[model samples]
Target chain A: MRNKWTKVLMSAMSASLLLTGASSAAMAKAKAAPQPVVLKVLYMSQQGYSTAVLNKMGAEFHKEHPNVTIEFTYLPYPQLHSAILTSAAAPVAQYDVVLSDLIWTGEFAAKGYTVALNNYIRQYIKNPKGIPQSVWNGLSVGGKVMAMPFLANFQNFYYNKKMLAEAGFKSGPKTMAQWLHQMQVLKAKHIVQYPYEDSWLQAEGLVCDYVRTAGEFGNGNLFNAKGQPIMNQGAALKALEWMRMLYKDGLANPNSLAADEPTAANAFASGQAAFNTNWTFVTGIMNNKSESKIVGQGVVSGFPVAPGTNRATLSASISGFQGLAIAANTPASLKPWAWKWIQFATSPAVQAQHLHSEWPIWSSVATSPQEKHLNPWYKVYQQNLNAVYNRPAVSNYLTVSSIIQQYVHEAIGGTIPVKTAANDMVQQIESLPK
Target chain B: MTSMPVESPPKRATLRHRLFRTLSGEYFWLYLLLLPSLLILVAVILIPMLFAFQMSLGNTSIVVLGGRGTISNQWVGLQNYLSLLQNPSFWQALRETLYFWVVSIFIEVTVGIGMAVLMNQSFFGRRIFRVIVFIPWAIPTVVNAMLWGMIFDGDNFGALNDLLLQWHVIQSPIVWLNPSALFPQIPWLSNALSYLGSNLAMNSIIVGDEWKTLPIVAILVLAGLQTIPHEYYEAARVEGASAWRQFRQITLPLIAPVLTVVLILRTMQLMRAFTLIFTLEQFGLPVLSIQAYQQAFSFGSFGMGSAVSFLIGLIALVIAYFYIKRLYREEL
Candidate 1:
C-alpha cells in the first residue's frame, strides 16, 4: 500500500513537469515562427538617370518592410546586359530578383533560371495592400511572372519650343507632313542646323522608334502581330525612306553622324539643334544647369504620324520591364518572405515614391498628375509612358537585335540602300533563333 | 681548328663571368629582385587570362548574370564555338575586324614612320609639334572614342558635316552615319575600299591612333639613325651620292631592324585595338576587338567571344611569329 501511493505521487510529479515543458516550447515557437528574410535584387543601369530608379526603389521598399533587407548592384549601360547574363544565368545565381528587358524573358524562362511566381502571386492578391497587376505579365513565356517591369523607359521626342514657333508653327507638328514642312521652314531660315535628330544608332532604340512611327502610319502589324520577323515590308521601307528624305532635304543636321544620345542631348541642350528624340532621362539632363542649354523651353512630343494615318502621335519603348521571377531552387522557407518582398516592391506606395524622382516609373496606376512635372519635360515623359509599347516580347529577341544593329547601322550610315538593308535584316532575322 | 685568337681578360675575368651567371640564374639575387614585378604581371595579367580562358569554356550568361562576375559556373563544352559558326553577325564582325586591323595597322605604320622621319629632321618648333602630335595618343581611349563619335554623328548638325559644308565643296551636308541615304559627296573616311588598292580606311584610322604611337616609332628610328654615322652621309656627299640615294641605301637598310621592331609593336597594339572602335562602331563601323567584345558581352556568348578574342590573339601571334622568324634570321 505504501509503495503504490509513492508511485502515484511520482507519476503526478512527472506529468506536471512535462506540461510545463510543452507550454514553454509553444511559447518559443510563437516567438520564432515568421522572422522576415533578407533578399538581394540586382539590375542594370544606363549611364544617365536609370540609376536613380534603383536608389528610389530601394529606399521606398525598405520603408514599407523594414524587417526585409534589400541590396542592389548597378552597372553601366553598355556593360549591363553582359553583366546580367554572366552572373544570374550561372549555376550559382547571385541575385534573387533581376531587372531585365521584357524581351529577355524568353531566354531566361527557356533556360529555367527564373521561376514561375503564380502560386505566390495568389497570396499577394488577398493582401490589404493590393499588388497592382503587372504590365509585363503577358510578355512572359509561361503564365508565370518571370520578371516584373522595374521601370518604364520609353523613347520621347525632345523639341525646342522656340525653334518650332520660329518655323511658323504655333505648336509642335501634329502630322508627318507638318513635321517635314517644319523641317523645310527651319532649313530655309537657317534657324536650326539640324532640324531634327532621332538617335538612330542601330541599337534596339532606333528600331523601336522606326516601328512605332511606321506602325502608326501602316495598314497592319510590323514584323508580325505575333512577334515574328518580317521587316522587308512597305511600312518598314517608308519609315527608312522618311529619315532618308529628311537627310536629303538639307533640313536635318549633317553632323548627326557624330551624335549618339549624349551628343544629341548636348546639341539640343546647347540650343544648337532644334529637335532631339531621346528617352525620359534626357529631361533630368536638360534641367541641370551645367549640362543643359534648354531648360524650361524644351517641349516633348509623341512621334509624328504619317499623312493619312489618323494616329495622333506614336510612342514606343526601346526596352521595358517584364514580370520578375524568383529562382526555382530558392529555399522553400524563403518563399513566403520573398513573395512579401515582391509584393512590397510592386506596391503603389513604392511606385509613387520612385516615380516622383527622375526615374521611369513603370506602375501606370501609381503615377500622379501632380508629380508629372519633376523635370523640364516630365509631362511629356508622362505622355510617352502612357503610349509606350514594349519591343517584341519574344525568346529570340536578342539574337534579332544583334543582326538588326549591324544591318541598321550600315543602312543608317548610308552604305546599303533602304531596300537592301531591309531585305538583309529580314534575312538575318529569319536566320536568327526563334 | 683553334678558336680564333679568343680574347680573354687578364684581370677580373672570373669575377665578371660569375656575376653574369648569378644575374641570369633562376634563384639568384637578380631573379629575386625581379620577383615583385613578375608577381604583379602574373596577378594582373596571367591569372585573369587563365580565368578568362576558363570562362570561355563555359556557357556564361552575359545578361541577368549580375555584375560581370560569378565565381563558379556550369560548363557548356564547345556550344559557344558552334553558336558562333551559326551566327551570321559573327562572320560579319570578323570581316569588319579584319578590315579594321589591316587598315589601322597600315595607316598607323606608314604615317607613324613618316612622322618619325619628320621629327628626326632639324626643324623649328619640332618639340612642340612632336608633343602636339602625341596629344591624341596620350588621351584615354574612352575620351578618344567619345570625341570621334561626336564628329561622326549623322545629323546635318554633326560637326564633321558642318566643317565639310563650311568648306563649300558640297551643296549640302551629308548624313555620315546613315547607310541608307546615299551621300552625294565622298567624305574620305566613310568610303569603302575595293581591297588592295590604296585603301583610305588607313587614313581615317591615322586620324585617331597614329598621333600617340608615331612618336614612339620616330624615337626608335632616331635611335637607329644615331648608329648610322654622319661620316657615312658626309662621305656619300663627298662621293656625290644624292640625299635620296643615301636614304634609300644606308639609312633604310641600317635602320630596317629597329623599324621592324616598331612595326611589330604597332601591329600588336593596333590588332587588339578596342576603345576607338567600340565607340565609333556604335556610330556604324566595328573593329576586330570591338567585334570580339560584342560577341562575348552583347550576345552573352562567352565561348564565341573568347574564340574571337583568341582568334585576335592568334592574328597577333602570326605577326609575332613572323617577328620571331625575323629575329632569329637577324641573329643568324
Candidate 2:
C-alpha cells in the first residue's frame, strides 16, 4: 500500500510540472510576438532608390518583429508634399511615415500635421548626436525636433573640369567676376555652347535659387531679425543684376529660365554647358557612365561669392534636405513602431549604405571610411553643407515661396525691372499677416 | 332636403381618379422621364457651383491639409472678390486669358475648316487619314502638352531645334518655349508689345491645343458638309460657277451655323484652358485658369480661387450668350 501511494504522488508531481512548463512556454511565445501592423510610408519617387532601400530595411525589420508589414507609395517630387499634407488632414491616418522636405518643417508642425519627434529620438535612437546640428535645425520647429533628417542636400558649384582646364584654369572660379571671365573665355573659345546653366524654373526651385543668391550677396541674411524681407537691399539687387547679366550676355543657357534641376543637370551631363549650379546629387548623376557623356570630367566647388565678398562672408546655398516624419494622426498603437522604423532608417549604418543616393545626413555616416570609399564627392558635399542657407520657415511658406518665385522669375525674365521686382517681393511678403 | 336626396348626389373626385388624370395628361410622362437628368444636373453642377459662390463670399483659407476637417467660415461679404480684383496678377491673368481665347479660337477655327474641307473629300485612304487626324484628339490633354513640351525643348536634342540646325536655318538653337528669349528677338516692337511678346509662348501652347481640338471641329464641320446636297455643287458646276464661289456662297453659308457652334464651344474651352497651360507654362504665362489653380492648390486660398473660377465662368457665360444670340439673329 505504501509503494502504490508513493507512485501516485510522483505521477501527480510530474504532471503538474509539465503543465507549468507548457503554460510558461506558451505565455513567453505570446509575449514575444508583435501585434500585426501595416505601416504605409509616403516618399518621393526617385527612380526606385528610396523604394529599394526602404524595402530592404523593412524586410530586415520584419524578420526581427515578425508581424509588421511595410507599404510604400511614391509620388513625383512636386506632388509628394501636397499628397502628404492631404493625407495627414484626412480623418483616418493614411501614412505613418512621410518623407518631408526640410522647408516644410515649420508649416507641417504649425499646422499640427506632424508629431514632434523629440521624445522618440531621445528614447529610441542610440546616438542622436550622429545628425549634424545644422540638419537638426532644419528639421526643428518651435525648438522641437519634428523629423529625422535622412538626406542632406545643398547647392554645389559643379564645373566641367576638362573645360576649365582647357580654358587655362586648373580649378573652379572663386568670385563672380572670375566666373564671368571664365564663362566669356569658354564662350569665345567655342569650348561650350553656353558657359553656365541654371535650374531657374518658376517653381519652388526658383525660390531656392533666389534665396541662395540673395543671401550670398546680402551679408548672409535674406530677412531681417523681425523676418521682414531684405531681398530688396543693395546686395540683393547686385545678385539679381548678376543673374540678369548672365541672361543678357548670353552666358547662361537661354533655356535656363524654363529648365528645372533635372533639365539643367542633363544640359551639363551632355557636355553642352561648361558649368552647372545644382544640388550635390548631380555629382553621382553626372558621374554615372550610362547617363553622362562627361563622366569623370565633372568636378565640384563652393558657389562663387560676389566680387567684393570673400568665402567667409558668403552664406551657404539653400538647404534642400529631406527628412522622415510621423503623421500626428498616426495611431498611438503604431507610434512606437513608426519611431523604430525612423530610427532604423536614419541610423548611421543604413545611411552609409545609401550615402551616395541619399547624401548622408549623419556626420558619422559622412565621416565613416566605408562611406568615403563609396562616395568620392562626400568632402565637397560636406563643404557645401557648411555654407547652406534655408528659406524662411513659416506656416505660409508655400504662399510666400510662390510670391518669391513670381517676382524673381519676372526679374530674371526681364518682364519687370529688377528694382521693381525686388520692391514688389518685399511689399507683397510684408503685407502678409504676421 | 329629403326630396332632393332622392336624386343621386354629385360624386366627389377620388384621389386615384385625379392621379390617373394627371398621369394621362400631355407632357406628364415627358416631365417624369426628364426627372433623372434634372437630378443629375443638380447634383453634378448646380450644388458645387452654388457652394463655390457661397465659399467665395467668405474669408476662409480652409486648406484641407492646413485646417481641421470642419467647414468653418468667417463671413466677409465680397472680400475675396474685391481682393482678387485688386491684385495685379489678376489683371495680368485676365489680359493674358483674353488674348489666349481670341487667338486660339481664330487659329483653331481656320485650321479646323481647312481640315474639314480636306476630310470631306472622297479618297482611297480616307478612313486611314481620318484615323490619323483623330489621333491627337484621342490623346489626353496633359499627354498632348507633354508631347509638345518635348518637341519644343530648347536643348540640342529637341526635334525642332535639331531639324532647324541640320537645315542650317539658324546659326544657334532657338529657345522656342522660353518667353524671355523669344521677346528680345523682336526689337522693333514697342515696350507694350514687348511685354506681350510672351504671347509667343501662348502661340506655341495654342499650336498643341489646336492640334488636339482641330479634329473635333473638323468632324463637326464635316458632318455639316455632308448634309449639304452634292447636287448643289453639281448644279454650280453646270452653271460654270467656280469652286471658290461655291465655297463662299453655298459651302460657307451652310457651315456658318456649325462654325458658330464651334466658336462658342472653343471659346468656353479656351477660357477654361488649364491642363495645357499648367503642364507647359505653369506660372510662366499666367492665365485665368492657371491663376485659379495656383490660388486654390498652390497657395491654398480656396475663397480667392473660387472667386477666380466664378469670374471665368461669368466671362464664358457672357461670351456664349452673345454667340447664341447672334445665331438666333442669323436664323431669323
Candidate 3:
C-alpha cells in the first residue's frame, strides 16, 4: 500500500509542474505583444493644417497601429511657447509630442525639456537626404538633432497687382530703394496712403521684420559667429534708421505701431495698402474670395534687398519654419509609439497633401509638380526659400527678442534717437545670462 | 433681572469630562466656525504672499529653459529693489500707473455721481435706463476693451474715423494711440515728460476704463442714495434750503462714507489695471502691472518681478492706510 501511494504522489507533482510551466509561457507571450497607448500632441492652431485634417491623419495613424491612440490640443502661436514650457515642467509631462517654433528649439533642447532625435532619425527615416542640411541644423542643439522638421516657411512679400499697376509698376520691387520709390509714387499719385503696411507692434513680429530688413541692408545676423551681438553696428543699425525714416516720413502706415500680423495682412487684403510682408498663411487669406477684397489682385514675390547689397543668392527673408519635438519626460514605454506617430505624420507623403496651405519641409515634396500646381506663388515662394534667414538660435532668443522689440519700437515711434536705441538694445542683450 | 439658576458644585468631574465641557464652550465653537476660512486664507493668500516676499529678497528666477523648470536662485538681498529704484523704466512705469489711477478714478467718480443723481429722479423708462447703464459693466472687460479698440482704431474702417469722415468733421483718419504724434512739443516740458508715454494713448485707455467702470460706480452710489430717509430732504425743503444747497449740505455729507469706500476700491483696481491695457496695447503702455508681467514672464526675471509686485503691494497698503485712518476719524 505504501509503494502505491508514493507513485501516485509523484505523478501528481509531475502534472502540477507541467501546468505551471505552460501558464508562465502564455503570460510571457502576452507581455511581449503591444499594449494600448494614448499619446497627447500639441500644435499651433493659428497656422498649418486645420484640426479636422490633423484629426483625420491621427485616425489614420491609429488604424495602422491598432493599439495606439493620438490626442491633440491646439493653441495660438504666441501661447504655444508658454504652454510648451508649462507642460514640460509638470510632474508628468502633459504632452508626449509638441510642435515648437524655430525660435524655441535651442531653449527647449538646452533645458532637456525636449529629447534628442538623432538616433531615431538614423534608425527610422528612409532617404533623409531629401531634407536640407540647413533644415537639420535649425532643429539641432550641440550637434544633435533635437526635433523633426515639420513645416518650412518664411515671410514672403505680398502686393496688390492693381495698386502696383495704378502706380505704373509692372512687377514687385526688387530692392528696398525701388520699393520706397514705388511707395512714394503710389502715395503721391493718391493710389494708396501709407503704401506699405507693417506689423511693427511691440512683439516678435517687429523682430522678424527687423531681421528681414537688416538682411536686405546686408547681414541680417543679430549675433556674430562668436555669439556676440553686433546689432549696434553695420546692417543692423542701418535697418533701424531706415525703419524710423519710414515712420517719420509717413511712408509706412502709422497704425502699424499697434498692428499685429493679421491686421497688417488685412490692410493688404482689403486693398487699403499696396504691399506687405507676412507668413505664407497670408497666401490663402490674400486670395480667398470671402476673406480678401484683392482675391485676384494679390501677387507674391521674393522679399526686396538693399540696392547696394547683393540680392543674387539670398534676400534674407526671415524664415519662420516650425518642427516637432517629443517631450523629454515622456515615458520610455510610450516613446517608441510617439516616434511612430511623428515619423508617420511628418513623412513626405503626408506633408505633400497640405502644400497649398503650408510649405513642405522636404525638398522632394517641394519640387513636386503637385505642390507648384496647387500653389500659384510656388515660384516666388521657392525663390524666397533660397535666401531665407533663420532668427538667432540662442537659448534666450525670446529675451533677446523682447529687448529688440522694445528699443526698436521706441526708435520707430521717435521716443529716442535710432543710434541710442540700437546701442541700448545691444547693451541689454549683452547683459542677459549666458 | 430674574435670579439665575445656580446648580451643583457636587461631584468631582473626570479629566475627560472637564476637557469636553471646555471644548463645548461658546468661544471654542466660535473659533471652530472660523477655522475653515482661516485655513483657506493662509493657504490661498498669506502663504503665496510670503513666498513672493521671500523670492523678492533673492535672485530667484524660474530658469525653465536652461534648468529643466527648476527655480534658480542666489541670495542677493535688497539688490532687486535697489536696481529697480535706479532703473529709469521702473520710475516711468510708476508715473504712468499713478497717472492711470488718478485720472480714471476722478472720471469714474464724477461721472458716476451724475449718473446716480439722474437715475435717482423719477423718469420714464427708469427700469430700462438702469439696465442700459449696467450693460457696459455687464459686458466682460476684454469684450469692452476690444469694442473700444475698434472704435478708437486709426484705420479708416474704424467706427470713429468712419463717423468723422461721414460728418465731414475730419478729412482724414487720426492715429488715436500714436505715441510720436501724441507727444506734446513744449520745449521745457517735452524733455521732462519724454518718458511720460503718449497722453493720447493713456487717455484712450482711461476713456475705455471709465465707460466700463462708470455703471458699477453709479449703481453703488445709487444704493447709498436709496438708504437716505425722505424726511431729511422734506425737512431741508421746509427750512427753505435751495436744491443745490440741499445737495451740498445734505447729499454730499450723507454719501461721503459710500464715496470713500468706492474711492478705496477703485484706487486698488486702477493700480492693477492690466486686462484693459494689455488687450488694447500690450507693452505699448509700460504701466506698473504690465511691467511686473514683462519682468516675470517675458524676461524670466522673477526676482525683479517679485520686487516690483512687492513694491506695488506696499504702495497700495500705504494708500489704504490713509483712507482707513480718514474713515476712522470721520466716524469719530
**Candidate of highest DockQ:** 3
Residue range A157-182, candidate 3, lDDT tens digits? 88888998988999988888888899
Model 3 chain B worst lDDT run, 10 consecutive residues: B61-70
TM-score of 3: 0.90
Candidate 2, residue A228: the lDDT equals 80
Q: Model 2: runs farther than 4 Å from truth?
A: A1-35, A55-66, A218-220, A307-315, B1-44, B63-68, B181-190, B194-198, B330-332
State the lDDT of candidate 1 residue by residue for A266-325, as single tens digits.
778878777777766666767678788778778777656666553433543333443445
Q: Candidate 3 at A158: error in angstroms?
A: 1.1
TM-score of 2: 0.88
True contacts kept of 1: 0.41
What lDDT tens digits, residue by residue, belong to model 3 across residues B1-332? 99999985645666667777777886688778889999999999999899888888898754344324456678899999999999888998898888788777778778888899999999899999999999998899989988988898787887888899899999878767654434356755665554554366788888888989999999999988888888999999999999999888888778878988998888888888899888777777888888888777656567888899988888877887887778778664
Docking class of 2: acceptable
If you score just chain A, what TM-score does every candidate get? 0.81, 0.91, 0.92
Model 2 residue A193 lDDT? 79
Clashes of 1: 54
Candidate numbers sorted by lDDT from highest down = 3, 2, 1
Which prediction has the highest lDDT against the true structure? 3
Ranking by TM-score: 3, 2, 1
Model 1 iRMSD vs. native: 6.1
Q: Is 1 or 2 the stronger prediction by DockQ?
A: 2
DockQ of 3: 0.30
Q: Given candidate 2, what's the lDDT at residue B65?
A: 42
